[model samples]
Target chain A: MVSALTCLFTPLLRAAELQSSLIASALWSGDSHNFKRQSHQFSLEPEAILRFDNRVKLTALMRLRSISFDGLAPQRVSDAAYSPLGKPLYMGNSSEFELREFYLELPSDNYYFTLGKQQVVWGKADGLKVLDIVNPQSYREFILEDFDDSRIPQWLANIETNVGEWDAQFLWIPEQSYHVLASEGGLYAPTSPLLLPQAPPVGVSVDVKAIDRPGRLLMDSDIGLRLSRFWKGWDLSLNYLYQYDNFALLYQDRSLTANGPHVTIQPQYRRTHVLGGSFSNAFDNWVLRGELAYFSDRYFLAEGLSDSDGITKGKEVSSVVGLDWTGLENTLISGQLFQSVALNRQSATVRDKSESTLSLLVNHTLLNDTLELRLIWLTNSNVGDGLMRLRVTYEWQDNLKTWASSDTFYGSEEGIFGQFDDNDRLIIGIELAFE
Target chain B: MKYPRLLSCWVGILSTPFFALTGLAQEPLSNAQATLPTGGQVAAHINSRDEGEAVSRKLSIVMRDKRGKTRKRETMSYRKYYAGEKRTVIFYLAPKNIRDTAFLTYDYNTPEREDDQWLYLPALRKVRRISAADRGDYFLGTDMTYEDIKLETRVSTADFNFKTVGNCDVDGHPGLHIEGTPKTQAIARELGYSKSLSCVDRQIWMVRQSQFWDIKGALLKTVTIANIDQIQGIWTQQNINVENHKTGHSTSLSFAEVDYQSPVPDTMFTTNAIKRGL
Candidate 1:
């Protein structure tokens, strides 16, 4: 079937510049108690672009993933959300294929327009996101995957123009997609106590209702606007977004019956208003960047099981400050401080009023950039928990590269990173590109 | 990104020496010329020369290691002057892994004010503001540093003290040799160079060959121009080779499809235009 599809598209693809990358990856559990092979993933990504004489461009990107596992299989076959617009095709229990992006770009001297499925990114911080909340994300591999791989593209209309010295961007996203999460029993699912609900009494039966998602095409569309300019060596931006929150809000109902206690959980989407600003400036070998965002509505689960609706709503404020130092010859040292606060904190909320995390990343290129080493450390002040990751990549040739990486989590179970301690894993992968 | 100034820096950094070439005097000096040109005078001649209004070109960089392993990158670059400052934007056109990646820079003529740069990684779909302070850092595994690319053609005479090293013959052509040392330790540190020696051809007023010494006073690298041609009445360097002795690596740059008559629009220098790709 794949061969037939390829044959059918061969002629059409010939007119466009086509490129593909094949990646094979393996994961092994690093847990002391459960030492075993986790899963193997193979992915193929192909992109094609066709351009017209008038500078109109059409681009299409597709991805296919097949996973083989012993005990770490995801319950869902596809990595994308079940959207009314479209969904990935499942070939088997562990294989799925998706048309990730298909966009047409029309450009002129002063104005540009892009229409179709695509990803829109914003903000300045890395690893810890503050205002980069345009596209929803896939948490199937947690946050270990690169943002490019994890971000879920949506159908949108993007228009950009120059307003004097400032560059302005406006977006209309109609496809309502939300975060794709790992199944509860999956290896990489969230185990943090603060994120999970309290344990119910023994013999109690729990019912989960189908998620309530926004499906109206234009009516449920998201709108965003951003204005950015470079002035006096500083890059600055102001942004606003009106959309549905990526994560669902859970509402629970509990009832006592003759048999025992019964609980029903309903997940529903909620609207949010976001206002953000970011700035970055470079001095000598150092680049400093920062982002601040205000979210009008954020929902968190209540602490106790008996709490009404088991949810609390509050206003949220998030900010991040980052610095990158490239003083050393082939090395880059980057540090970022991220903080998120619940402005209207509820006493019964599961999370604290404020959470702060610090991340340090060091990347070094060696042997004419054929070999690369990277290390990242992230710690939270409130939880005293953090994640440490190390990766090494060797490029045998310009078109091929191999890498080995390890992710480690430490601290008490209640902390975000600490909850995934047992899920620490080592991954080895190879990527080969064909142009 | 005017091609003339493109060659100016290219000529200044790669094809010419740190000081003036007596050829710009419109006359070749005999064996016994009474007066010799200083480094500042030569730099001023190179800087003041007129090239053109705007320009675009295709650039190919080939890098090879001591082991004979080679990698190549191809880019489409556009340059134009906005007021007095020069703005350049380069878009990667080859090597599928980095295709659509772009880099933009605002090079200021002011000695005290720093320049600004932005890099767009297609994978991230974001334009990043990067510091222009690391002028000594190698650019994309190439032998040339950011300084080599930015400050080459218009050699900053104030940053270095120049002296005549005497006349010599380069490739059978009579040439003037000039030596330049950094004026201050801070400037030396920023440039990662202690001293530079340049051999300028007497006929073209362009540096035919140059050598640099590292801050530690060790012989670092040598650059030689292999080809030069007059395009649109401007002497343009077509091919350049750089060898880094310390790393046992070399880079070769060749420019083609040099267009000096076309209009390189102001819109091409914006961050938004880079994202649009070429």
Candidate 2:
């Protein structure tokens, strides 16, 4: 299906006088730990926009990525008590180089249509909230390693239209795999343990299994309104989205012990809804912004579960406010506060976590346009944690940029009564982007 | 007998009172009009150098929903300029909660005409650049561009037709309103004012007010000048207000204090100064 669309769009793009080029490179680094290593990558992404005489416009992106990494073996079990009775597990480090994005878009005066694999960021993502980053989730160990290229679905179709200040979009996802949640509550966990029925030590030998189900189809529709001037000094925006997922489910009732009581679970076959609104205003030296959002509980639970019987059922509401003072030409001071809460008790069971954070950031330029520096400090009340990061970026030219960054995270949990060492990380790398 | 007659005629001419009075009246008189400078010459001098400061009051309005309910806020600020020197200070006086916040910006005006701006966040004790392109796109998100802050003094670039409309009192000072228009399309686009007209004060030769329009002739913004004053013998416009009619938001500047001839060190605009937060 992807090839067919490419074949069809290739001719159209050629006829429209479209042109594109691609470039890529790779680098590798070794760690003193022997098993840990890292790699550097470079890519040239260029797109040619062509407008046919018929007023039909076609655009395509020629994307590429270079990957290099160290070869590391998977952790081995040293004790027989915890080791699984199977062929000794042996996993090796692997890396691949490939083109990440190659897609064509057809846009008319009022509407646009895109077909092929593309990176899609559904919700507002600032490193924290990535509700719908549905491409391939990179299993890479380091965050920077995953930055080379994004995991995107093999097939996708999208249509967008704008009427006045309002915009609407519809997305279709075909042949996409939903991420399977592991029995252990971690982003990436080791393979699950298999237990026989009616085993002893329920907590100790409750075998867990990792299931790879068939891919499913998904669809989402979004509507947005632009209210830039409905008021005296405020800018407003409102958006709503509805998503339908097939073969998407949550593992609600997984028995840790064999032959344990059956855990009533929520079904997986429901729709998810999200609604949000935002406002922005600037007065003299101060700029103010705020946002309010609500997500239906159905989206957080298993698909087929009844609202009344589900273990976690309810709604979530989030609000944020920020103020920025622009007293100096290149200087700005800002403060932000945010809160999220589950409305009902049933919802609170699944979303009982609430947090508040304060952050300060400063950026300045040095050596003309050659060097730039940024410093940031963030503190969170919930974990009593604090983070500080310093980054120095140098831009050699339009195509080349490099930065050295260092970050430290420190925190302590009350009642835990233990001192914890601050986790410190340093990263230095260069990037070359071309067109 | 002829020489004697010629000598008598010369004597009678020297004694004529009317001729003597006419010579006295022809002498030049030094009055107020004679002391006043030419408007064109004054404009050239003001545009020759790029260093000044101004105070301002800004009003921002937000309108939401189909019903059109509006929210408005106002603030006061003190601004200083060193032209290409790259550093500026803005002190906010109003809004008691934000009085302590002072903004200091460092600019890197590249040869490409792209300016990189950095801001010092006092509370954060850090300096951050104006990273986002959209941050400098508008004046407080209004129609005013960043270039607007550096008023265009290039009069020769535009085909100006100056017509003294009438005499009027502006802030207690008598002033003349002259209208100017761009003569060519290319020049209009370069100035970022495709279809705009300006009113220049006849006395001080300063821009009193200007209205900008789109190519389709729709009003985009209206910039007005006020508080005309003399700072260290240099005539200056102390306040400027730019209002976007479509958005109901206005960015006004008041020059709290100014010094045109103050000596500013060249080292102040360098990249090192920006890093040191000087």
Candidate 3:
């Protein structure tokens, strides 16, 4: 295991106080669709942070996951969009070792620089993610795993400095990596039969294949900017980003074959411009936050068009408003409203012109704060789909916790939650961190 | 997460104790009270003493159940007070599960407004806005309620009538007893208190002990302060304990590594800093 090898370097790196933790968790989950089909998963996460006296800081994190099941099916290749790392790599069912973050930070009086891969979180809205961009995500587990673990880090350069009362952050990424979709036939993948709306009839023998993403690092680079300040109980931020889409759009590559007409599926990225802003204010017993972002030249998949693949250009505006109240007895209640509107209706045909979503969270403590009861509910008004998750956690110590949770979804087949209506699961896991 | 910081309980966002006696409080005093200096004179003297703009300290807090079982928590804190503005941030350093949890609070001098607070939970990877109301709600099941902790800010001279009870020796210091009752039924219910009693150290004008009485004339709780020391030129209480008679529960807060006017960064007192973690 890499953990063994990393352990060897701990002594050499800890002169500046190396901080590290090893977290392992397992869950037994049963799908609602087939009660008889059950699966188990075990994951281990090892992370470490070191700050050198030479004004440099380094952090490394890695995760290994394994799954075991009874009557689990094989990976389906119906859609070539399946992620390579998204599929389970098994000795039975273990994942290949994944290195999540490895970065160096150099700080100075006037400016500070960060080089290497990292996750740059930008929003204050809980669960909304209106402005929390800058990194791609692996939605293989949907929203079950915390973003700290799910948000894929990107190789980039970051610089920040304070000019008078304003703080500014700049980011430049040399390589473009797209979002990793759930593996085909996996738990969270979209499962449905579709009919191509318009297409030329193809000989049953004709074959279709995929071409990978662009390999040249400079061809698809990303850059962003953020300006922020805290004034009079309010924290405000303005942002701009030019990045590739996390989800790829498919385009048809024509080829002449001996059999007849042949098509090659190629993933395409639409260079997008995102302009965003965020604000947070703390008042008596209440905290308020709002965020909004506008996207130019956003791309949309041409759903229902099976014969020929095409990508459409559109625009979008997304916003979130959230609040937290801690007025009750040892209870915290938080809620957020998210709404995204397609600015260009003609090009954005796959989804509705506007979609509104709501999320609510309630947490209460009992038994001298040793036990906590928490519930979160999210619903989309456009699709009439929603998911409710409940969790009970007991803290044995500061660094250890054991939890049992259940996630249930309700919706139509084409909806986000509807597609996985039968994949509802119960989870129990233990996590411990040490340094 | 540090239970205290995660639950935002007993944060001890205390202001200068000497200044707490300046406003409207009521009641008449005994011979003991007559022998001591007036609250005004005592307050003026305390204010004139050496008080700095900031303070930092380590804290060991313990809460005990009725059965005498105890839970211990530890934290390090930095606080800065500037005229009408105050900011404090506390970091949980012990009881490892809650270690690295951080809490930030902003206290405003405006009367109609309440203090602002935020909590960072490493587990959620999020800093949450914690809304606190000075209601009769216990802090993380501790004996001291939010109302009890906000004793100074929630009560004013216009709401209560104060009087001197008598001379008394509090924690081996010469002190004057003071009793205050809400001026109206509404004010009494709002504070969940009918009467408040306190013993003030005559020399330093600091509150050495205090007791709360409910509307039904039953004793609710009593708090004691001890281990006084002059740190950073200011009189500081190193240990404070609270006993809730009705609930039979108690909480004790002990201070250590106390530092005054230390160079705590202004950035350390903000939510952004709290989110960044220790």
TM-score of chain B of each: 0.87, 0.50, 0.79
Winner by TM-score: 1
What lDDT would candidate 1 get against the real structure?
Answer: 0.76
Docking class of 2: incorrect
Worst 10 residues of 2 chain A by lDDT: A414-423
Q: Which lDDT tens digits does candidate 3 get at residues B1-278?
A: 22232422333312112112212232346554476565444434433544457777787778776887676778777777767867778787655456567877776767456667677776555665555453445655466654444332122444456555556566468776656677789657655667776666768766677677777877877777777788867788787777777867788888888788668777778665675555
Two-way DockQ contest, 2 vs 3, winner: 3
User: What docking class should model 1 receive?
Assistant: acceptable
Looking at candidate 2, what is the lDDT of residue B167? 41
Q: What's chain A's TM-score in each predicted model?
A: 0.91, 0.65, 0.85
Better of 2 and 3 by lDDT: 3
TM-score of candidate 3 relative to the true fold: 0.83
**Candidate 2 per-residue C-alpha lDDT over A185-298 given as tens digits, one digit per residue, 9 for 90 to 100:** 221222211100122343433323333233233342222222222134344556454543322333445443455544433334444465776665555446566666677743
